[model samples]
Target chain A: MSRYVLRRVVESAVTLILATIVVFAGIRALPGDPARTLAGEESDPATLAAIRATYGLDEPLPVQYLRYVQKAATGDLGRSPRTGLPVAESIGHALPVTLQLAVFAIAIAVLMGIGTGVVAAVRRRRPAEWGANAIALLGLSVPNFWFGQMAILALAIAYPLLPASGFVSVFEDPVESFRHLLMPATVLGTGLAAIIMRQTRSAMLDALTADYVRTARAKGLSSAQVVLGHALRNSLIVVITVVGLQLGALISGAVVTEQLFVLPGFGKLTIDAVFTRDYPMIQGVVLVTATAYIVINLVVDLLYSVIDPRIRVGGPAL
Target chain B: MSLLEVQDLTVRFRTEEGPVLAVDEASFSVATREVVALVGESGCGKSVTALALTDLLPRNASVAGAIQLNGVRPSPRARGRDIAYIFQEPMTSLNPVLTVGRQIGEVLKRHQGASSRARIIELLELVGIPLPGRRIGEYPHQLSGGMRQRVMIAMAVACRPKLLVADEPTTALDVTVQAGILDVLRNLRDEIGTALLLITHDLGVVADIADRVVVMYAGRVIEQAGVHRLFAHPTHPYTRGLLDAVPTPGRPVLKEIPGRVPVMRATSDACTFADRCWRVTEQCRSVRPVLEPGPAGHPARCWHPLGGKE
Candidate 1:
């Protein structure tokens, strides 16, 4: 297990390096120059030169990549071109908000999805299965952005129940922060829940038909025990994989949701940086998202051993 | 009195194409301290009949007629405590995610309510799994195929069921391992005195372990007699064909049963085996022959018995 973990960590590091190179190349290849975007038309050439030099934008591509790698290795993500603030510091401030939203959304999605999945699988051929399936379809079909806008319109503008936009720090007042987060989380989480629920239901249905389940029943176990004991444990592996893949999407979803709710999360920060051409902030956010994706997959892969011992990470046993 | 008496039991599956008759009105019994082998080829409803005994048939299947266990008609919903089924594929029969001990312990907890750790270990050791203390923590995938089948047997016998139905238990195993598994089952029968219902297509396996044998063809029992009588002087043409098919060492080239078992399209009013029988006649094709005594308490389902001595 330790060897497996070590191997995964090394693979993740390589993935992160590849991702950094790709993101850097793509951003640098964009049409508009960062120097031009930073300095307006009224600025003198010398001032532009100075600005470019200060940001190290005038360096060769190879040299610029080296500096970028160096800074990332040391946890210094350079300074934002728009705000002229340290990119790491800006992201640090925004990350907590995004993390809070993502965690809450995922928690709700997993709980509700797995619960409804178990119910649907157990009550197969019943009205509950149809109802759960319908809900899942609705969740999958409705876009998160549209859902967010509709939720804001319905709950904030018309009903006047929730605050329409803006975020409150949880440290200031936990209850107020929760209230601010509730609607966005619901909108973002609904789609994830639907996906997970559908997968879980399907996996559970397949597991229930397995020979072991029949053996469990032949042992005189009750219907509930047969489903939960034999079916659910095996079915959870697929659900876990789906949930892990969704973590990346959840972070991405938080960006649009944060914008709608006016929450200062990584999503909102990245969007702001994109509009102003803040290369440092944009790179920093992308790096963090990439890291999150790699790490979540690594964790999910490690969990496979615990869920089903037959899956060995280091290839077939020697 | 027989420990298990299944009389005129019929099982059918409702498929999208049509209603397929899986197990045609089959009747047989297992007496206490006796081993009865239900022998047949694949798709002859041998496994389905065993499954029906424990109400383990699939959802679309409809089972009718009487299945009395210890004088009580056991329903599909309430059969586990009295009748337990060991399926063909031992590799898949045990839960992959669960430990062998827990899988066996589940039967105890469910039927006998034996929840103590010590009791589970005791049951594990009883099935010949080594180092029950350390091995109890290992999952089904950790064990070998033979060990897994032992775990399956342990689970089936956990409740001390009156009748144990083994559906081709050794079919998935190698020849050498097959004998060991059969020995384990035979020993269990001798030790616990539980009536054993062994279902298989292998005549050689039945010859070695079974006291009585019921030969089936086209989802119907064609012959049943003591093992000695069936082997020494077989009656039904299907039984004779099955015996002829088994290859014997140092014997001249074996006789093969020409053509496959006929598929039952509609409920047969005539002999189901008439299509494949070399001695088939107009009467054989026109009238279905029910089981009747041949010799030495042997019952053969045929108009004309094979082996003229009978």
Candidate 2:
């Protein structure tokens, strides 16, 4: 197990290095010049040159990349040209909001996904299963940005219950934070819920037909115990994988939903950095998002061993 | 009175090509403390008959006729408490995620409330699983195939069920392990006085453990008699064919049955085994043979019986 963990850590480090190289190269490959963007468009050539030299952009690409890697390793992402603040500080500010939204969305997705999946699989031929399947299809079909706007129109305009386009820190006021986050989190969760539900349903269908399920039934366990206790636990290995992948995706790719809801999250930060050619902020966001993706997958791998005793990492069967 | 009685039980499955009769008009009973073997070759409906006993067939399969226990029809609620089923593949029969103790304990808890941990260990010990205390915590894959089957048997007998239906229980085990599993099952029957309905394609296992043998071919019970009687003086040709097919030690040549068991059609007039039977006459081909009584009141389904003299 320790060997497994060590190997995974090494692999994650390699992935991070590769991701940094790609992000750094890709940002540089973008058409706009960061130095010219930082300086006024009408500024003299010498001023732009001075800005480029100061940021070390005038140096060769490899030297600049090495310097960027060195600075990033020490937790110093160069200052954002837009706000003149350290990119690390700005990312830190935006990360909590994105993490909170991701966490909430995933919680909602998992609960709804597993619950509906179990129900659908257990009462497979019944009307309830049909209804759950239809709901899942709708969840998968609707766009999150469109759903977010519809929620605002229905909840904020029609009902006047929530402020649809703002975020509040949960530490300051828990109730207000929940109220503000409920719509966007749910909107972001719907697609994830659908994906998770389909995977869970198919996995559960396979599990329900397993020989062990018949053994459980032959033991006089109720249908509830047979489905939930015997089958659902086995099905969760598949659902967890989907959750990890979809959760990471939501954390990094919720830019449009954030824009629709006006949440100042890392996704929003990423979009702003991209348009204004803020190299440091863009690289920092990509690095953090990629790291979160890797970490989430690693955590999921650990969870597989925990949930299934059959999965013994880095060892032959006992 | 018989502990479990199945009368005229027939199971049909509805598929895209319409219904297929898996088990047709099969009838048998297991008296108190009796080991009744339902023996047949593969695809002869032995396993389907066992599944029908516990009402565990899939949704597409429809079962007809009656299954009564202690003179009363057992409901689905009474299925596990009174009758339990062990499947062919023990590796897949035991839940991979649950500990051996938890799986056994669950049955006890459901049937007999508040099943303590001590009871789980006792059940494990009953099935000959070693180190009952430590082994109880291990998962299914941690154990060998024979050990996994022991866990399955432990779960089945946890409730002290009146009748245990084992569908080809030891077919997946190696030759050496098969004997030990059979011994454990025999011990279970002797100790608990639980009636055993052993389903198998192996005639050797039937001779070893079964008291009465019900020989099935093409989804019908073709012969039913005491195991010793049936082996000594086989009444039906199909039963004779089955007994002949078993390889004997030092035998010059093993006898082989002529053809495969044909799949049944919805409206068939011909005998199921006529195509495979050596004595396939014109009367046998055009008309189906019904199960009729033979000498000593043994039942054999054949138009021409192999009488003791023959």
Candidate 3:
């Protein structure tokens, strides 16, 4: 298992390198001159050139890439073109907000999804099943952005129940921060919850019909015990996979929701960077997001072995 | 008195097409200390009948008639520890994520509440599993197929039930492992005196283990008799067809019961085996023969049973 983990870590490092190259290349290819944008239209050619040189844009593409790699290795992400502050510091400031939203969204999704799915699967042909399925359909079909706007309008504009715009750090005021974070998290999480609920219901349905479940029943176990004890454990592997996939989307969605709520998170930062053509900020966010995605997947893979011993840690023993 | 008496048991699944009969008024019994083999091809409803005894049939399935276990009236909500079931695939029958000891321990805990860890280990050891003390902590995947099957048997017999219903326990095993599993079951029966209902398609397995044989054909019993008598003078055309299909050492290539078991499109008022039986006649197609004695203690369900003038 240790060897398997070591091998996976090596593979993950290679994947990370490839991802970095793709993001770096793709950002560089986009039609925009960060130096010109930073200098503004009124600036003279010499001032633009100085700005370009400062940002290492005057170097050849290969030389710039090599510098980016070297700096990235040393945790130096340069400075935001718009703010002239270090990009790493900006990211650090924004990351916690994104993390906070992602965690809350995921928690909500899992709790509601698994709960609804188990109930629907057990009830099976009942009206509750139909209702659960319908809710899942609604969740899958409705766009997150649309939902976010709706939530803001309903809770912020219509009812004035929640703070419509701006974010407060939980460390500053836990109660106020929760109140501000609640609506955005719910908006982002509901869609994922519906998906999880639907997937979990289907998985539970399949697991309930498995031969082992029948064996559990034949052992004189109560229906609840059979469903909860035997069926749920087997169905959890699929649920965990869905949860892992949604974590990336949740982090991405936090950006949109953060913007709607006026939260100074990675999403808003990235959007601002895109508008101002802040190459350093954009590149830094992309690298961090990509790394998070890869790391989460690795964690989930390790978890699979823990959840189900059947999954061999390493390749089959040759 | 019989340990289990399944009288006129019929199970029908409500499909979108119609109500498809899976088990057609199948009647059989198991006496204490007796192993009755419910022998049939796949889809012959042997497993359905076994499941119906414990009300373990699926929700779509509608089962009718009486299933009495040791004079106790059967109910859908009745505890099933009195009649345990061992399924065909052991790897699947035992929860893959759980330890073998815990799986067996669950049955004990459920039925016999507060059972000690030592007792669980003893049950594992009883099933001939090695390292019972240490192995109990290991998950199902750590165990081999034969070992898994033994764990299943251990789980089934944990409650010391009156009847153990083994549905093709050795069908998923290699020939050598198959004998070992059968031997374990036979020994368990001898030790515990728990009546066994062995369901399988293998005639050789039945011949080797069963004291009585109940042959099923397309959801109905075709022939039933003492193991020796049935083997000596196979009656129903379906039973003879099945026996002839079994490969014998130094004999000609075995004949198969050509074509699959008919998918019951409509209610089976006509003979279920008419399409496949070589000796099928107009009368065989017109009237579905009920199980009746062809000789003392031997029942055959056929219009013109073989080796009979009745």
Candidate 4:
């Protein structure tokens, strides 16, 4: 098991390096030059040269990349030209907000998704299942931005129950933080919740019909026990896989949601970095995002072994 | 009184195609510790009948008739407490995600509301799972087909259910592994006096473990007799066709009962096997023959039943 983890860590390292290269090349490929973007309009020629030299834009791409990697290894991510703040510090500030939102989103998605999915499957062909299905369809079909607006208008504008768009630190006040992030988190989580529901419902349907389920039923377990203990647990392996893959979507959704809510998160930081072409901030954010993906996938792999003993025998999918 | 009595049991599924009859007035009983085999071809309603015994059929199914244990209907509480089921696919019959111990423990827990680790180990040992201590920690996928079936048997017998309804327990196993599972089930019956309802298509399996055999054709109980008597006398034409289809040492080529079972329409209108029977008579087509004793005093639902000579 440790060997499997060690191997994954090595693989993650390789992927991170590849991601850095892609991010560097991708940013460089953009029409606007970092030197030009950093050196403002009406700047003299000497100023441009000085900016280029200072940022190592004058160096060969490989040399610059190696320098970037070296500094990055030593916990230096350079300063953003836009904010003139350390890239790492900017990300540090934004990371917590997005992390909290992500945690909230995941919690909401799993509870809503699995809960409804079990209900639909157990009450299959009934009115409850139909209602759940209709809700899932609507959730999947509706646009997030539009949903966000409607939610803000209804909850914030019409009723004035919540602050329309803002951010609050959970460490400061947990309940207030929940109230603040609830709208954006739900809007972001809606798509994932719908997806998990669809997957869980189908998986659960299959599980409910499985031979094991029959054995469970014949054991005289209540309908709830049979569905939850026997069927739902079996279906969770599929649900876990879906949650792992859909996390990328959640991250992307955060990009849109955080911006709409005007919360100072990695999403807003990323968008602003792209619009203004702040190369350091962009690289730092992408690197952290890539690292997060790699780590979460590794965690997902570990979770598979926990949920399914079969995976332990085969040592997972390499 | 019999340990189990299933009388006039009927099951139909409401599907998009239509209301399909899966089991039709199927009646049988298993006396205390008796091993009764319900044998038939695929789609002949054997599995459905077994599921109906425990109210285990799918939501689309509507079941009618009586399933009584010990002279009273087996209530919902009778499941796993008085009766337990082992399905055909041992590969799938045991939950893949759970340890063998946990699966078996669940039965004890459901009925008794408390289960000890020691009792679980004992059940595993009773089913002949090697290294019950270690096997308890392992999941279904880790075990071989035979071992998984043993685990299923252990779970079924955890509460010492009066009857263990095993639906084709050996069908998914290898030829070599099949005997071991059958032996485990037989041991279950012999050791605990647990009545066994063995559902299968294999006559060889019927010959192996069953004391009496009930033959089904197109959702109807076409024949029922002592296993040896049924195999020896082989009264009904369909029963003869089935027995004759089995190869003997002297036979040059194996005989096969041709034609698939009909997509039944109005079950009682005629003999369900008439279309597939070589000796099918006009009477066989015009009316349904209830199960009645033939000239040999052997019960078979047929217009013409063979005499006692094979």
- The prediction achieving the highest lDDT against the true structure is 4
Q: Evaluate model 2: give its lDDT.
A: 0.87
Q: Is the docking of candidate 1 incorrect, acceptable, medium or high quality?
A: medium
Residue-level lDDT tens digits of model 4 in B14-132: 88887788888989899999999998889999989988887878878999999889999888888998988888888877878888888888889889989988999999899888899
Native-referenced Cα lDDT, model 1: 0.85
User: What part of the reference interface contacts, as a 0 to 1 fraction, does candidate 4 reproduce?
Assistant: 0.87
Candidate 2, A1-318: lDDT as tens digits: 677777777898898899889988998888988888888789999999899887788899999899899999999988887889999999999988888887888888888988888888878889989999999999999988788889999999999999978889888899998998888889999888888888989999999999899888878799889998999999999998888878766774478778889999988899899888888888899888888888888889888888887774332443
Task: State the displacement of the C-alpha of residue B194, model 4, in Å, after optimal TM-score superposition.
Answer: 0.4
Candidate 2 residue A188 C-alpha distance from true site, Å: 1.0
Q: Quality of candidate 4's docking, in CAPRI categories?
A: medium
Superposed Cα deviation of residue A135, candidate 1 (Å): 2.1
Name the better of 3 and 4 by lDDT.
4
Q: Which of the predicted structures, 3 or 4, would earn the higher TM-score when compared with the native?
A: 4
Backbone clash tally (model 4): 0
Separate DockQ for every predicted complex:
0.60, 0.69, 0.58, 0.69
lDDT score of model 3? 0.86
TM-score, prediction 3: 0.92
Better of 1 and 3 by DockQ: 1
lDDT of 1 by residue, A1-318 (tens): 788778889999999999999989989888787787788867789988998999998989889999999989999999887887898999899999988888889888988899999999988889999999999999999998899889888999899888877777778888888888889888989999999999999999999899888888888888888887789998999999999988878887888898888888899888888888888888999998899899999989999878877775333331
Give TM-scores of chain A for all candidates. Answer: 0.93, 0.95, 0.93, 0.96
Ranking by DockQ: 2, 4, 1, 3
lDDT of 2 at A60: 97
Candidates 1 and 4 compared by TM-score, better number: 4
Task: Give all TM-scores, in the order shown.
Answer: 0.94, 0.95, 0.92, 0.96
Worst 10 residues of 1 chain B by lDDT: B75-84
